[model samples]
Target: MTIIVAGVVVLVLGILAQVLGWGAEHHEAAGHAAAAHGAAHEEGSSVLIKRILVSLWHSNLFFLGVSTIGTVFMAINYVAYAGWSVMVKRISEALSAWVIPGGVIMLLVFFIGRHDIFHWTHDGIMDKLVNGKPNPHYDEIIAGKSGFLNLPFYVIRMVSYLVIWGAFSWKLRQLSLQEDLNGGTYWFHKSITASALFLVLYAVTSSMAAWDWVMSVDTHWFSTMFGWYVFASWWVSGIAAIALTAIFLKQAGYLKGLSSNHLHDLGKLMFGFSIFWTYVWFAQFMLIWYANLPEEAVYYNQRLGGFEGRYTGLFYFNIAINFVFPFLGLMTRDAKRQMIIMKIVAIAILCGHWSDFYLMLMPATLRGENGFLIEIGIAAIFLGAFLILFTRRLASASLVPVNHPFLDESIHHTT
Candidate 1:
C-alpha cells in the first residue's frame, strides 16, 4: 500500500513537473519576446517533455529487462542443476511479474510517444531527399538503414521480443508452481527443457531487443557490442536485485535459513559482472575511439564533447558507481559475506546501473540539467511499483521451493 501510494505520488509529481515546465516554456514563447527566442523556448520545452517521456519509458524497460533476466538467471541454474540458488529461486521468479505490465507500458509508449522518442517516425525524416539525391532531414545515414529501421518492422520486432520474454517468464513460473504442488520429476524435467530453450531464445532476442530499443535511438550509430553491453549492465543489476530481495526476506524471517553463503555467491556474481560490464564499456569505446570513424566516433563525441558536456562526467560516474565501487567494495571474501556490506553494495549497484541506463539513453535523447529530477521521479515511480508487484508475487508462493529436489542441498549449501 505504501509502495503503491509512493508510485502514484512520484508518477504524478513527474507528470506535473513536466507539465509545469512546459507551461513556463510555453508562456515564455508566447510573450513579447523575439520570435527566434520564442521558437527556441518552444522547441526546448518540446524536447524536454520528449526526453522525460523517453527516460520514463526506458526506466520502466530497464526494470522489465532486469526482472526478466532475474528469471533467466534462475532458468540457467535450473538447466545447470545448480544447488546454491534453490533457496531463493522464488524471489527471482517473483520478479518476473514486472515483465507483463512493463511490456504493455512499453508498447503504449512506442505507439503513442512514437514521435517524441523516435526521430525516424517523424514526417519526411526518412523520405526526404538529400542533395537532390536521397533522404534529407539531417538523417541520410539513418535513411540508408531504413530497410531495417522502418516503423512497421520496428514495432513488430519490439512486440515480438516482449511476447517471447513474457511467454517464457509466465510458463516458467507456472511450471515452478506446478512442481511445488505435485513434487515430481516430470515438472522438473519440463522446466529444465523449457529453461534450456529459453536460454537459446534469450541469446538471440536479448541482443536484437537491445539494438531495437536503445541503439536505434541514435539512428546513425551502430555497435556490435551494444547488446552484450546492455545484457551485462542489466544482468548485474538483476543479481544485485536478487541479493537485496533475499536480504529483505531473511531479515523479515520469511526466508529462514538463507545463509551468508547464498549472499556470497550473489555478491561474487555482482563482482564478476561489474567487471564484465566495464570490459564491454571499454571495448566499445576503445574500438570506436581508436578507429576514429566519424560515424561511430560521433556517438561518443556527443556524450563527451559539446558545451553541455555533463554526460562526460556521468560517463565516468557510471563507471565509479557500477564498476569501481562494487569492484573495490566487494573485492574481499569477508566483504561478500557481510550482510551489511552486501546490502550497501547491492543498493549502490542498482542506483549505479540506473545511472548507466540514463547515460545510455538520455545523452542521445534529451539535453540540459533537468535530468536529475526526471531520473529521481521516474525511478521512484517505477521502483515503487516494481516493489509492490514483486513483493506480492513473492508472498504468493513459499519463500523457498519446498518441493524442489535439491531443497535439502540448497538449505545446507556452504560457500
Candidate 2:
C-alpha cells in the first residue's frame, strides 16, 4: 500500500512535468509563430503532440478495460482450472487495480463528451416530448432496454460490476499472500471458494460490460456471440500480458526459479488462444456475411465503411499478427522455450489485440477509421499508470510463491 501511494505520487509528478514542460515549450513557440515561418511549423508540431496524446488516451482506456476484464476472468480461471497459477496470479490481480479509477475517468469522459460519444444522452434529440409524454429519439430501442441502459441504471450496473470484480481480486490476492505466510490450507480453501463465486458473477458482468461499453455504440445491433467474442479477445490479451510480464521478471533477476518450461507453457497458451480468438472472429464474421441479414450486415457495413478503412485494415492485420505470426513463430517446441522468441511473439500478440480492441471501440465511438491524439494520450496515460503500479507491487513482494505446496511444480512447469 505504501509502495502504491508513493508510486502514485511519483507518477503524478511525472505527468505534471510532461504537461508543464511540453505546455511551456508550446506556449513560447506559439507566441513566436507569427514572426517566423519555422516557428509556424513548430506550432504545427504541437498539433501532432495533441493527436499523439489523444491516441495514447484512447489506447490507455482500451488497455484498462481489457486488463480489468482479464483480471476478473483470470481469477475465475484459477478457480475453474483448479490448478496452480500462483506464480503469475499476482500479475493478473495487479492488472485489475487500475479499473476503478480508470472506469471513473471513463464515465467522466463519457458524460463530458456525451454529445460526441453517445447519441442517446441528449434530451432534445434522444429524449424529447412525444404525445405529451417523454419519448427518447431511439425510443423503441431505449424502451426495450430501459431497465439496463438508462443513465442511472447504467451507472449502478457498472459500479456493481467494478465493485464485485475489484473486491474479488483484492481478496483473492490477500489470501494468496496470507497462505504464503501462514503455510496453511485455510486461506487457500477460502480463496478457491471466493474465486468460484466470483467466476459466476464475472460471466454475467463481463457480458453486460462488453455490451454496455462496446456493443452499445451501435445501439441497434445485437449478437448472442458478442460476449464470447469479447471474452476471446481479452483472454488472448491477458495471457499475452502474463507472458510479457513473466519475461520482464525473468530478465530483471526475479522469478529466476521459473524455468524455460514456464515460458514454453505461457507461449503455447498465447499461441493457442490467438488461434481460438481468430476462430471466434472468423465465425462471427462469416455468419454475418453469409446470412446477409440487413440488420446483422449493418454492423459489418459500418465497420467496413469508407470512414473506417484504417480500422478495417487493422482488423485484418490483427489476424495476421495475432494468429498467423504467433502460430508460425511459436509452432516449434524449441521456439516456445526461447525467451527472445516468446517475447517477440508476446509483443506481436499484445499489439494485435490492442488493434483488435481499437477496432471494437473506435469505429463505434468515433464512427471513423483512423486513431488520433486523444486516443494516443489516453493509452499512454493508462499504460504508464499500469506499468508504474504493477512494477511497484512486484518490487514490494517476493516473485515466487515461497510457501505453496506446488511451488516446485510452477518452478519446473514442465509439459
Candidate 3:
C-alpha cells in the first residue's frame, strides 16, 4: 500500500518537474525560431500546428492499437498456458494490464492531435501529383498501400491483434489461477500446449504490429528484421520493468519470499537481452548501411541529415546506455546482489527503454526538430496511467504465486 502511494507521489512530482522544465525550454526555443523566421514563422506555425496535431493523433492510434494487442496476448496466454509460467507469469500479465487504460488515453491523444502526425488525414491531398506524377512522400506509395493501410483495415487489424493478445493474456492468467484450485496435471499439459500455440500466433501478430506502427512511417524503406528489432526492444524493456517493479515490491514488504537469486537471474537476463537488442539494432543498421541501396539508405539519411548530430549522438548513446552499461555493471555477481548497484542498473535499463522507444518513434515522427513538451506530456500521461494500472493489478493478487509448483524451486534457487 505504501509502495503504491510512493509511486504515485514520485510520478506526480517527476512529471511536474519535467513539464515545468521542458515547457519553459520549449517556449524559449519557439521564441527563437519565431525571431529567426520572422513572419514566415507565423505562416509555418499554422503548418506546424497542423502537423503536430496529426502526429499526436497518429501516436495515440499507434499506442491504443498496440496496447490492445499486447493486453490480449497476456489475457489469452493466462487462459492457455497456466502452468510452466505459473510462477513468472504475473510479470507479463501485469504489463498487459498496464497497457489497457494507458492504451485508451493514448488513443484519445491521437484523436485530438491528428493533424500533427499523419499525412493521410489531409483532405483530398493524396490526389495531387507533381509534374504528372504523384509525390511518394505525400501520396503515391502510402496511398497505394492504403488498400491495406486505409483507416478501416487499419482498425480491423488493430482489433484483431487486441483480440488475440488479450485472449492469450487473460486465459493464461485464468488457467494459472485454476491450477491453484484444481491441482491437475491436465492443466499443466494444457498450458504447455497453449504456450506453444500462443508463441506462433504471437510471432505473426507482433510482426504485423511492428510493421504497421513503426516501419510504415518510412513507407519506402523496409527491413525484414524490423519486427525482430522491435521484439528485442520490448522484450528487454519488459523484463527490465519486471525487475524494477519486483525490486520495488520486495523492498516495500511485498513479494516476501523472493530472494537475491531471483534478482540475480533478472539482472543476468537484463544483461543478456541488452546485448541481444544491440545485436539486432546493429544487424539492421549494418545491412542497410553496407548495401547502400537507395531505399534502405534513405531511412538512415533522414535521421542523419534531418536530425544533424543529435540523431547520430543518440544512436551511439543508446548502445552505450542499453548495452555497454549493463555489460559492465551487472557482470559481477556482487554487483547484482548489492541493492544500490541494482537500483542504478535498473534505472539505467528503464532509461534505455525510454531512449529505445524514443529512437523508434522520433526519428520517424519528428525527423529534424528537437523533441518538445508534447512528446514528454504524452509520455507522462501514458506512464501515469500505466503505473496506476500496474500498482492496482499488483495489489489485486498475491505478490508471488503461492500455489505455483515452482514456488519451491524459485525459493530455493541459488548458484
Q: Please tell me which predicted candidate would have the highest lDDT against the true structure.
A: 1
The alpha-carbon deviation from the true structure for residue 142 of candidate 1, after best TM-score superposition, in angstroms, is 1.3
Q: Candidate 3: where is the Cα deviation over 4 Å?
A: 1-88, 106-115, 120-138
> Compared with the true structure, what per-residue lDDT tens digits does model 2 show for residues 143-213?
56656667888778878877886777778778877877888677766877887898888889888887877
Write down the worst ten-residue block by lDDT for model 3.
37-46
Give candidate 1 misplaced runs (Cα > 4 Å): 1-45, 128-138
lDDT-based ranking: 1, 2, 3
Tens digit of lDDT per residue, candidate 3, span 336-381? 7766677788788766766666676665545444453444454455
Which ten-residue region of model 2 has the weakest summed lDDT?
Answer: 36-45
In model 1, how large is the Cα lDDT of residue 261? 92
Two-way TM-score contest, 1 vs 2, winner: 1
lDDT tens digits by residue: candidate 1, 303-392: 784324657888778889988899999999999998899999999998998888787776556544334655676777788888888889
TM-score of each: 0.90, 0.81, 0.78
